[model samples]
Target: MKIEGIVLIGIGAFMAVVSVGYWFWSGEPSGTAMLIGAVLLGLLPGGYYYWWAKRMKPRPEDRPDATTREGAGVIGSFPHGSIWPLVFGAGAFLFGLALAFGWWFLPPALGLMLVAATGVTTQSRRGGAI
Candidate 1:
């Protein structure tokens, strides 16, 4: 993770330097903005990873002689299956159809989408399987 953070910071710095060059070459505002945006995109993740590495405790991989087996363990809980995804998909489809059809279809579609989202969010609290 430390190495990853260093690499990301390097990449971000490189992008920023390149953006400066681009701005010097072409004085166009849009192009300059894009270049600056690219620099920002790179820096955001780099900064996040760097901060995370500093804040979090070192993992097994941080050790010089750590083995692959040393890092092996259950990652986290994952849902086996759920019906909410299908409901969400249906709502999405309806929303898309509403856009192509009439205004009357919009309300119902939006309502369905809201309901589906709520169902998915509350399912776990209700002891429902994912």
Candidate 2:
């Protein structure tokens, strides 16, 4: 994570320099603005990851002396065979189809999405064996 964050920050820094040069050379705002946006895309999450990395204990992978066995174990329980995800996909499909079929599909789509979201949340809160 720390290395990842550093790489992203490096990318953002490189882009920033490029953007400045591009702005001066082309004298165009749009391309410079997009380049600036790219800078933010790299920086924002990079900063977040770096910040969290600083606070977290280094993982087995992060440690030089750690063995493969040190990392081999159950990390945490994750949801399996979940139905809410399928329902959410169905709702999302309906929403997309509404663009061509009619505006009438919008309400039902939204409703289905909301219901699925709520169900997933409920299931997650219940913990283990979804």
Candidate 3:
């Protein structure tokens, strides 16, 4: 994480410097905006990882005498198959289709999207498969 953060910061800084140089030479506002966005994008995750590494407890890898077996275990649980994605996809498709077809299709598509989003969000609370 620390290495990744450093790399991201470097990339962002490089982008910003190049963009600023380009803007000065060509006077393009688009490049300036892009550089600003790039800097923010790089800073957000870089800062997050730097903060996270500092705040987190030292892991097995951080210890000089730690064994490989010390890090072997279930890291976390993940959801398998779920129907909510399909529902959401259908709603999205309908919403897009409505843009070219008719405005009347918006209500049902939006409703399905909302319902599916709510169901996915609340599935863990209900102790159901996601």
Best by lDDT: 2
Task: For candidate 3, list the clashing residue pairs, or say none.
Answer: none
Weakest 10 consecutive residues of candidate 3 by summed lDDT: 121-130
**Number of colliding residue pairs in each model:** 1, 0, 0
* Best model number under TM-score: 2
Tens-digit per-residue lDDT, 16-62, candidate 1 = 89888887887778877987787777778888988999999778878
> TM per model?
0.73, 0.84, 0.82
lDDT of 3 by residue, 1-130 (tens): 5666787888778877887888899898987888889888887888787778788866787677889899998765467767888999999999999999999889989999999999788875665444
Order of quality (TM-score)? 2, 3, 1
Q: Judged by lDDT against the true structure, how good is candidate 3?
A: 0.82
Model 3 TM-score (2 dp): 0.82
How many times do residue backbones clash in model 1? 1
Model 2 per-residue lDDT tens digits across residues 1-130: 7998998998899999999999999999999999999999889999998999999988898889999899988876786678999999999999999999899999989999999999988898888544
Q: State the C-alpha lDDT per candidate.
A: 0.80, 0.90, 0.82
